[model samples]
Target: MKFQKPDFNPRIMPPKLKVLTLEVEKFDNNFAGVCYKNGRRYVIDGAIPGDVVKAAAVESFNNITYCGLLAVVKPSEKRVRPKCRYYDSCGGCDFMAVGLKDELAFKTDYVRRRLFPFGTEVRDAATEKGFRNKITLAFEKTNGKLNVGFIDDKTKKVTDVSECLMHEAVFSDLVKALRFWIEDNDVSIYVPRFGTGTLRFAVARYLDGQLLLTVVGTKSLPSTEDLYKKLKKRFPKVGLFENVNAEKTNEAVVGDVKHLYGEKFIESEMLGIKFRLGPDSFFQTNAAVCGKIYEDALEIVRGKNPSVVYDMYSGIGITSALFSRVAKKVVSVEIVKKAARAQKELLSENGISNVEVIEGDTEEALKNVAVEKGGVFFVDPPRRGLSGATEEILRFEPKAVLYLSCNPDTLVKDVEKFVAAGYKAVSATPYNMFRATTHVEIMVLLEKIENDE
Candidate 1:
């Protein structure tokens, strides 16, 4: 079962619709609940579970129907006022309007709800916090003025974002410095109309309290060395890297990464295990709390030790090594070649020989890999969740499946597929990666049911 492209266009729906009583059932990726109305399902925003609201049907795109909240008829106990003034304007933080503790509870419930089909034994699991190891920020320059912010969900407009609670306090100053540098250098801003210019994006990730900033632009930076030097002097904790996009597109990723500061890359530790990260390597952003994630994940694999483990969507193979200590062997698959190289180098440098880093798409790679019976499987995929074909691969029925996700709604849907395949979700733990946003990360453990039983 390959992942099919959605056929529906999002702009086909009415521009404005009459408000109707819409009930939000659960969080799905960046969107809210799947609203039920008059035998039609409208994917709604700003409505949480247990909340009844008057919503206006809006756009439909790529098989997803969207609705906006017109009025809240009934609110959930989790609802709260967003702390940041930019929360409503900036689309980066959605769940900021909801209580932090309740958000965790909602994410936890979503996991338990998916496991309901496996057995009657359902329990509320404890969640962890403060463990984010990766974060990305876009750099936008309009009319020779530089701005660092996120894209608006509704209008797709870039709003300058400075103070995100989820980001470290030091990042605020970095944004200011980058803006000042652009202004000082009189560098031409990259315009979609012109298709060439200077700085375009600034992405930074924190691991083990160390920060790595990657500045992306359309052309070579003139003051890359100076900027790195100044930033290193200002904040010695941050390692700087410069990158060029060069491509004439809206994509934020860079084509080439240049080491401007530090030692070309940075290293972080988790549970006595060390891992090296390059400029573009995918890792979590919140540095202080990922230890809890490693601990909780290790607990899930406790009784199942001395087994081979397959780590799908394993970014840089950090989690792969986390499981390698207890497991007999760990094979981690990453789609990006650069990340796979980094994983291989890091593992080899650390003298870790039990793990194999395969570079290929997880769904495509899993098609060829042999899944030995009783081997533990861990998948930490992107927010889009598991593809239908990827779910079908679970038909091999590994002993236990530990799913780590940043989106709860997709987790629920994937859980449905797993339940259908006769697997039971045993426990889950939510970890707060984006503190001020609606996004949450969860680690779920599921056990496979024997066919004869």
Candidate 2:
């Protein structure tokens, strides 16, 4: 069965809104302000922690109220003004309205709360603006005209982006050029209902001083060469590409891709290891914070003194490449053939030969690969976490299993499963990969529970 992401476009009707005044006590896992009004728990957006705000109840389900911020009657001292102009509309940065100090404090408790009873250490990952290496803007209709930017969390409409603090300044300028080109050339934007348009999305990635731009539309535009020539004049090192996405699906970048100009791939250095990135590469947006997480994981690996390392579900083999520096041999199992081949090429480029790339599903590949008893298994799965791979890892019974998760909800559940299987979570650390937001990267180390003498 093919997998599909939920379509973001949904028709919204105006509903009767109820008003209430509440004092926000703290932040929930989603970074929304949680307040109690007359014994009813309300989750309010745009209201910071420790704030007295008036909100309109949007709806209620399961005895919990969901609302939108009406006004901040009394603002909290910890609430700092947003730095990004698009903070009010753009859903790209969820925590733009929050101060750095408070953001970290909430993330710390957020991770510790889920992994209770385990000693959790949340690192300081406060980063500045323009930390993202990639940007994807969708082309849609707004106010009877074409616009491009991120989707609004509430409205699900494209917000025109002229300046974004999350991405490089060049990307913002490129967005302006693309929007103008769409308006000047009179390009048709994709309409989900009618399902007709020339343009659908614009993807741009910056790596090592070069830009890889891609235009996603129903079909190739006639004026694509002209747009490329314009971008080339402004930015010398730029590559333009096209991704034809005709299906009405949630995926922004899909279909057959063709290189329009310049280089086809961009090389970026991550964690002191240089690797190539394409339009569809699963690269981390924040390089600095990603480096911090990898470095910490390597330090933990060193203390284990493993003879070999097993990297399961390794995407592009970034962790495998880094783990190869210390361990005698590292095996990376990846399902994607393209990423597996690229990992081989990347390892060869750096003259590292101890790492082996196995192209197959992690669960199936785990049966074929042989792991030593003193080795560590590192698994970085998707948001769904390990499905049936739990039994596979238990069968291997490595010295330790390192689970890196993007969703804490799944992490807690998986950790309990391991605990029941004779494993104890030794330590959990949260990395603020996406700063100014509740989304975090956590690494939990689980060691086998040996019978005491």
Candidate 3:
């Protein structure tokens, strides 16, 4: 069912919500719960398996529905108090009520269950911990003062979250300090009304105990120079500073960037390869787990060193570089022009001459590359799964295809399609990248059937 429908009424609950007892079966991901309500299959929220919770109807759209906890009819043995104070209202995290260790286990199990339908088990999956590296908080004004927090679920109303459990303690402190800094300077918060103002967003990255600040606004901020200078003065170890003016109505930071402090970008090492990350480039939030994920992807390309490797949806080219080292040639396909350009620059700077950046849709770009008789194809599509065109390209058949997905439901659906297209599922590896949340990332390796034409 499409989640594009209008918001559910707050007063009207879903029908049969009260009578149905939810036995949380498994977690789909953050914001979704898999449970059997009233002896029928149902996806519930605010309840997990082994927790006998009295769930009250919250909302229902199409076939999917949401419920709120009315009483703990029963509690899971592994359940624990959420660490953040914004657990109830703040929408940043959906698994705050789950224990860290148990949450990881549940995520792993979610992947395993999804693969069960295909008769594949993820055996070598790792439970990566302490891997959260980045987070984006909404910037809004509350009580006539600038406040940094996440918006309530299904609403633009800001929810004040002083403490976010996903981030390290220092990062949270930076958010607080930033709010004070903006308020003290009397800078106007960029309101979305006709899109005219400065101070739209403040995204900070914590690396090596140093923060890289990127301030975004609808219009250029006049005080950006002074603000950067003051922030650097207060925090001596600030690594990089940038100001981005996104005049467009979208949330993405797409504008002329001014390097207020430090170099144009900062360098971070991942999977033994160097990556250049600017404020605009996309990188995995959990860096350490990403290293393992990259390693696993490399393992799929082991021994059978192909003449060419196609890294589809190559985000910032991290995976592209990793595969380039082993393959005779690697071609990275990405739609974002800026990120593709950054990948090109990084490849050139690192003296990695074997890789080429193709800026376009993966499905279209892959058709242009002349893959040798035995070449590998790696596709990491978005949560929505592969594009229809990309799916058709996969049907054309490659030696081996490595499918990396952050959502199991979509992964299962896509894998089923691959299996139907004469691809054999050789292996699947599940990883718990997001702890204390239902999110799980998986790597699936499939090979073309010998009988396939």
Candidate 4:
């Protein structure tokens, strides 16, 4: 039988396309729709909850499959028309098509599910539309023309977005002007493939009617001086900066920054506290929601009446300054030296003598802090969450820990570690800080249990 077998070519057969009708049950953390078929789960992008769609299996792994929505057989009741013209292509807003109420509910549910057995209270964003105070637009060369927009989700290509609904109207106006300037001047657009061109990213931050605009490129542009003049004339209260990043990396801001015009930093006030924001400073995008978060956190600290509060990963000491208003003494630990200097300046400007800024890593800075029994630790760690600092924080065995987190997964993990260390989770509150996006901010209050093994 083997000798008589005929030669066959596998390449002659076409791959079978598995298309199925899927009824989306809910949305996952990444805003992808979850559906079940044949006792296996499938995640389909571009499909909302309650959507009955025709989807094709794109890939399979283990017992799960990923799919692409081919057609919407039935749309969800929560679905609404997205405001932005580039919603289909732009990857900026994932829940733009869903109603605001539904979006908030989903975000709250998502956080609650991640932190199960912990009671959570959800708060909607103060401003649902035009809430973003900062916008960073990427530039790509397409057909010898400069396209400024976000990278597309499905194709991973740069999609030309003229306007974004989430950003302020001023942001769109600035983008229009920048696009015109690039086209009129025939400026070189950065193409990573060819390793040629100049401009890479345009970042605009709005605060207190002032705009801080940063033009990022590989090298200094020859027409920057002239362009700055034009831009200043157009936008009266604009601070222009040039950031040169020639390392061939994906970073937005890099080496050799020059303040071309206006002030070196933009001044903004949150909850009656003034903050000087530079090009690299970290500030929440939604000012009003951030104020709410700070108010809630301050309330938690006020209840404890801690003599000393340790603000870990304190950026520019805004929260630390706020803590100084309640706590007797506040110790702020930051990794960035420049930010620590800024924090010192801000504390002086605000006449806040209680907060002492320490420029070092949190894990090392904790060693020098005198951890009293009634002391409280307020940690606003990065998205990666607490690392070795978690152990250091527990070593203090403070009265309470107020942890603010942007990533719920890491937040839950850290909370579990705290629980294991004899700390009881008192309350977990989720805030809709980043609207229209799949991001949620959680503030958890943990108190040490007495006589725990």
Candidate 5:
């Protein structure tokens, strides 16, 4: 028996695949449909809830399976033709095939599920199309030719998108102009694998009839002056910047930046407050939806009339300026020095003297700030949500805490912490900030219990 061992190859015996028709129960936050078959659940991409699709099991993991849609046996009533020609290949929009009404409903329901038992009001974006104020396009080299656009979902290749439906018309014009400029100048595209080439990403921010364009590259190119001239000609009120990102990493933009032409920052107004945005400053993409969120947040803290308000993670002090209008004094904490400096300039230009900008880490800065009782804390953390400073901020025992989150999962986790710290989640509101995408923004108001301390 020991000498009779036979050689076998695992590749020769593949798992049997069965094509089955499954009805999608619901769609998750990522736009992947959840379908149940024979008492087991399967996740199918490109399938919407209420759709019956013929799919084959692609892979199995743990208790659930993943399948690839073969054909739509019965399409959902919510299904619609995607407006953008690139929607089929481009990975930017997942819900494009679904109707906008259905998309909003799914997002609202997703938020409700995450923050169960908390009353919520869902607000849709004013306009579903052309709402993005900023767009970042990636550059790639394929077959010794320059390619620029979004990455495809299935092929994992760069899809040459002449226009994106989510961005304004001017953005499309700029993209076309930039692509032409690159081709005419024979610009070298950055290839991260080999750590060679030049241009990496083209990021454009449009606001108040002006544009801020940041070209990220591995090194400075001699053609920047000409490229700037071409862009300025097309976009009269354009600010051109070259961001040198020499590292071999996946980050789109980082490291030293130099202003090539026009103003270093573009001025934009939100909620009657002026803001100076730089190429790297973080501003909400959907201005209309963002304004509504801010208005609601302001309303929540207006009644408190706190003597001092802490605007944590304040980017260029938009929220801080808004708080200054209500609170006697507002302190903004931001780790980015340039952003903090811009905030200071914005406040001074607007004659807003009540707000003070602190350029330092939020956690460290919170420790030094005077924790006055009855103060209001307005936190707008990143997608990962609150860091280790959650407990430290709670120690202040602020009169109220308003949390603005882009990821509901993380928001719910942090809300649990706030609840344990004797704060009650009074209201949670979801905003459809990013249309045709699975992402959503939520604002939660937490009030401290009177006798918790």
Candidate 6:
């Protein structure tokens, strides 16, 4: 999800400057505060709305200045004591310093600024603690000692947190276990420059009560059997696995996964429907906010009651499962080979027979599927919205199109194209999925506009 940057003028390039006192006006997407001084915008990290902060300029570009917050001369009323001890140091959360109420309000206004003239409304989430169901920790070596933690977005430094209140309560204990296991076993930490190490990353996912963990390394560890025993002792129901990512790149993405212990697919639920999720399954970390999006889509389905529903870019088929209940038949077009089968299995697990899974690109699959001219489209695309699929989807002449987007800019870009293709904008509602963060999940509705031909 894209955050608002410093509102800067492109033609006016500002030069580097020294330290100064600035009253922060508002927050950008990164939870940094923005303030204008002498017709220039300064973005100070860790500053908040209504704050009087002392800042030193790090760099300046085009009218926008990046600064570091030295001290808070006067704290804003919006500021509150952060719950996480590592909130000041850890790079996990974006808005931990601000109160939850104010954070939600800021996010609501942010959606308005992005999706103007669509009558947008933000469904503020009440999620604060235990909101996330997933966590990824980076493994680094500092001075020949194993360090496991989250990597800071700016400095690229990794710092471990004693407690992570985002996921299940057991995560805090789980991290300690990882530290002891990696350090005691003398595990080799992956170094990108030298390209010789084992431990690269640790990924944990929790659903309801079941937890799944995958310890990633450049190559399989000989001591993995010991790690599996430790996990089974702590989290009995935990699915233990080791992922091999032998690629020379520094990215933590897994290449091959091997299940070591426990359940392969954890049974998870969303809106009362149970679904099975594997280790590599893509799901929204914030479950409560995802429910809000699904509920709103259900409401739209109730209003339209179309005969056929086309779920374009359906990942894992969760939305398709929901659509199958309301529509007579649901056609899902998914591109990834593995994802296509996963969608079919997900629907089958829930006893859903109405959804026909088409394993191919949206444009090609649409040609073979028989659709009612009155069918509606449901799309929750990746950041690079629609790309070339928007025109193909509009060709169906669906009665309505409900789009869920994480990137506001792409959402607007795709919506504009739909409007040009004889669709009228109905409403755009943004959902705050992540707590204490500026990230937004938006859902926009468009209806076909009929005219005298």
lDDT of each: 0.70, 0.79, 0.70, 0.81, 0.81, 0.79
Encode model 6's per-residue lDDT on 39-111: one tens digit a residue: 9988987789899998777667788888777779999998888888777667678688877778778877776
The better-scoring model by lDDT among 3 and 5 is 5
Q: Please provide, for model 3 over 169-258, each residue's C-alpha lDDT reduced to its tens digit, 9 standing for 90 to 100.
A: 776566666766676778777667556557777776665555677777665565666666665765655644455666555454565556
The parts of candidate 1 lying over 4 Å away from their true place are 1-44, 48-67, 70-78, 114-135, 140-145, 193-196, 361-372, 383-397, 407-422, 451-453
Clashing pairs in 2: none
Where does model 5 exceed 4 Å of error? 1-18, 117-130, 451-453
Reference-based TM-score, model 4: 0.92
Relative to the unseen true structure, what is the C-alpha lDDT of residue 221 in candidate 3, on a scale of 0 to 100?
A: 64
| Candidate 4 residue spans exceeding 4 A from truth | 1-16, 118-130
| Candidate closer to the true structure by TM-score (higher is better), 3 or 4 | 4
lDDT over C-alpha atoms for residue 347 of model 5: 91
lDDT of 5 by residue, 328-363 (tens): 999899998888888898899888999878899888
| TM-score for each predicted model, relative to the true structure | 0.79, 0.92, 0.85, 0.92, 0.91, 0.91
Better of 1 and 4 by TM-score: 4
By summed lDDT, which 10 consecutive residues of candidate 4 come out lowest? 1-10
**Per-residue CA lDDT of candidate 2, range 31-97, in tens?**
7789876778888866788899987777676658887777899988888888988877787777877
Off by over 4 Å in 6: 1-17, 28-31, 117-130
Task: Order the numbered candidates by TM-score, best leading.
Answer: 4, 2, 5, 6, 3, 1
- Model 1's TM-score against the true structure: 0.79
Candidate 2 segments whose C-alpha is farther than 4 A from its true place: 1-15, 119-130
Model 6 Cα RMSD, Å? 4.2
Candidate 5 lDDT: 0.81
